[model samples]
Target: MRLRTGDGGETIDRQDIDVNQVRIGLDLSVPARLGGLELTPSGTVHVRRDGGAGQTGDGIEVAVGLRAVLGTARLDAQARTLAHHRAEKATASAAWR
Candidate 1:
């Protein structure tokens, strides 16, 4: 038989996956108006683990993201790995105010 997890990953033998994780994250963005432009240099960090039963193996993900906000628009000119790496992600968004 075959099975799959929420991580878009497949498992054989019903791997009996046991995922346990502890995450610490931080986001620091210094936003300010330079001349006539508004900019914010942002960054983030993440660390966690995904282990299977019998201590088979653990899947760990450590990602970082950097973005900038220009006026009412935000651009992720880099790998946007911020927030928790869940089953899904957000591609883009806008600021209402």
Candidate 2:
């Protein structure tokens, strides 16, 4: 995912996505004196199968991120399921200006 904002002084741009093969998204925000912030959330979902009928399997995954001048951070979360079993994971980070 990618997100960018200009110093236009107005907040009026955003986007999102979710699909079977791949997913991506972006967001934008105007600059502010106190604090300017922008967030982008995106992920992918894929499925693969073998040649045999019983060799087919599927799963899901996702992630999210945020960026800013004052403070920047990103969070990622994912979940997957295969053969009736499920697993999930998450992580986060931050930075100072």
Candidate 3:
């Protein structure tokens, strides 16, 4: 679990724009061994609120993933979704080591 806050500003031409936000996140995972392989399942959630011009009111992100390891080989796969006022996005990724 984690919590964070941030403030930022940018200047373009002769105008200044500012943004402030607070975010909280939590992650959980469990691992189990089956024979010679280790398998883990994990999930995460993040919530955020923003204040400033053109900023979205609030947002949330959710994700789930799986990881497997055996000897020197490791594999991971994850899918995530981010949703906010007026827009939503989704992503997925996999990696091998």
TM-score for every candidate vs. truth?
0.42, 0.24, 0.64
Question: Residue 48 error for model 1, in Å?
Answer: 2.8
TM-score of 1: 0.42
lDDT (Cα, tens digit) per residue for candidate 2, span 17-36? 33333223333333334435
Best by TM-score: 3
lDDT by residue (1-97, candidate 1, tens digit) is 6556777755486455565655555666677776756666665554544334533222223333445555677776544433333322223222222
| Clash pairs, model 1 backbone | none
Ranking by lDDT: 3, 1, 2
lDDT of 3 by residue, 4-96 (tens): 446544434556567887789999999999999999999998887767765446677778999999999999999887644332243333343
Tell me the lDDT of model 1 at 70. 57
lDDT (0 to 1) per candidate:
0.49, 0.34, 0.75
The better candidate by lDDT, 2 or 3, is 3
Stretches of candidate 1 off by over 4 Å are: 1-15, 54-66, 70-72, 80-97
Q: Which predicted model would earn the best lDDT?
A: 3
Error of 2 at 9 (Å): 70
